[model samples]
Target: MATLSILNHDRKIFDKKYIYPVLSRRAGGLSLGINLNTNNACNWQCIYCEIPNLTRGKPESIDTKLLKEELFFWLHEITQNNFLSNHAPPDTLLKDIAFSGNGEPTAAKEFEEVINIVITAINEFKLNNLITIRLITNGSYMSDQSVQNAWSLINQTPKEVWFKIDSVDNDDIKMINQINPSLNATKKNIESCLDVSPTIIQTCVIKINGELPSKKSIDQYISFLKNYEKKLKGIHLYSLARPTEQKITTKIERLTEKELQSVADKISVLNLPISTYI
Candidate 1:
């Protein structure tokens, strides 16, 4: 009776501690998700985040043994025990194993161990060419050597890190992502991730107050991306699909289809593959 919903990204839908499944719009089908941050904590408090009661912090200590057991169990269910047929829509393909919890997954101390577990699953299921291993991150700790080393372990399988880059203006960044981030540091992280993994730029665009992204902001965003046009895998531009639960001062609103298309038209000048989800 556990029907998966693409719009309802509630990680706790199945009562699982570390593993869950969702019909992901981005992944295009059943995305087996690994929720490392069960505590609803994150480094950046994005105003558009759908997670309720989100706090600012790193992930707590991971129970790797339990996590491994859950991962293997879910893999078995999907591959052999008819999980998709029973829990998700009929003929749902197992698209990817995404490390996309409520918080920044790279903050977990056992991130490398989890990657090792994924390697084992890949070999066990013989899914080398069938599915992808995705790390949906905010790109904060991508420069860490340990993180890079862990993520680089699975070379043969299809992999992608959907790094979030909402905006380039610091004021816009602060308003949307709630972080006084250093663009230089972000650049370094981007470089490190590119060196280790095939990366896609995941940007969530929302109307602030009552206006769409200004032309100046769009220009700055395009300018920053011009440097990575060759190195990046692609860009994902999407407006909010779910309502925000975070209590913030700014009045956030989902961009209309026209508004989103308008933004995409401006970014299309970069000539990179862009997919927009409303």
Candidate 2:
């Protein structure tokens, strides 16, 4: 049996241009992560973000060639060597190649080109059918033409998109995400994502200063889910698993398993699939 821990998702193992390996609980095994935002920047600053020293900005220019090389090298190592069997816990396997890192991946200026490079690498490695591809995003850049084009490419593969929709209330959004994106705009972007590929709503529910989300807030979230329950794949309801880098860390608290189940129960009323990680 593999004896490696899957809970720690540190992004600096290789510290290369784009590729990093993680034992993802959600992915259920080793996941190759692509980090285009090497600058440690993102448009939104979610209070619960685990990235240390995160800044508000788009990624600096991406070196697609370097990214491709790094990806192919890692893929070869993981598959040909005893990478997983030696580094991960027993029974671990390659789960997915995920576009997730310190920031919003779609915010990279060369996102479309980046996707192409990733696809080429995946095909070269001949692991396209052996693994899943995933995009973990804030769903804020779906309106951009380049981002949409990238999504079009992703639609051609066996992939899943984990879109973040933490709260429906703009006030709560500001409090949590530190940005005031209109609720309508966010909904429209999410709908756009659903049009391009399969999407799962990923929500992180946590207590603020020891208080759970208000009933009104939960109702609004449920209502939003009801609107697209038919097209949605499911909901990933999880709590804070890592320490935050934000100054508000003291104000944040992880919800217990019981509390996460409560939230999941409410969303389950929509008759959509729900998964919890606490």
Candidate 3:
């Protein structure tokens, strides 16, 4: 049977449209996810993205009314009912309500409104101290003021942003994240994220055509992160946990524990803490 476990990675644990739950390795427990990209659209076409039929576009308009309903219903189910006991493993805590779904959540036009709805639900359920409100984002739209304002309202609950920094070199970034980006713009967005909330640099290192990241790429990444050593929370270095849906799947491979640790050890030059997930 498909229940919440390390092996059961299905995103849809229920029939809801917007909200679902998952067992997150980084989160260390169950993460209630809000998937705004019901159309499965995104601004980037990352090579290691797992979303099938990935396209280059923004998300369709969000139905904030329906989203609020789903968020509240799930919060009630987890907090006031026996949903976790039945679906999740024993002793598993509700880790966070993560804005991670099929694509970049901030692409939705109603991004700020959605954050407001989430705060309302978290307040009603009184999950302020027990769980965190997490935004798993690519840091592309972190510079927008409306998005920053939305994040500022959550004073009662603990909050964190998993801002992705897959690569610092533009060439490697275009190949990995599949976007033509300026390093300056990337740094500016990350700085914006730091101003709004606690930020963690989330990186995905993947083997392409049977080779790991080049030393130059890793060096650039480490140097870029050095600038935020004091301002940021920490770093999350992970490889592909699930298979990629992009066309280059034949060349992509997961990192072994030794290889992952080696990269982590090299990144230890910066004094911040680092966590690895496979």
Best by lDDT: 1
List, residue by residue over 1-278, the lDDT tens digit for candidate 3.
24787655556657778888888889999899999888888888888898888888888888889989988887887888988888888988899999997889887888888888988888788888999999999989999887888888888899999999988898888888889979988988999999989999999988888888888988998899999999999999999888888887448888998898899998899989999887
Error of 3 at 105 (Å): 0.8
Error of 1 at 104 (Å): 0.3
Clashes of 2: 4
TM-score of 3: 0.97
Off by over 4 Å in 3: none
Q: Is candidate 1 or candidate 3 better by TM-score?
A: 1
Ranking by TM-score: 1, 3, 2
Residue clash pairs of candidate 1: none
Per-residue CA lDDT of candidate 1, range 12-110, in tens? 887889999899989999999999998889999999998888999988899999998888888998899878888887778999999999899999999
lDDT of 1: 0.91
Q: Highest TM-score among the candidates is held by which one? A: 1
- Which of the predicted structures, 1 or 2, would earn the higher TM-score when compared with the native? 1
Q: For model 3, give the 10-residue run with minimal summed lDDT.
A: 1-10
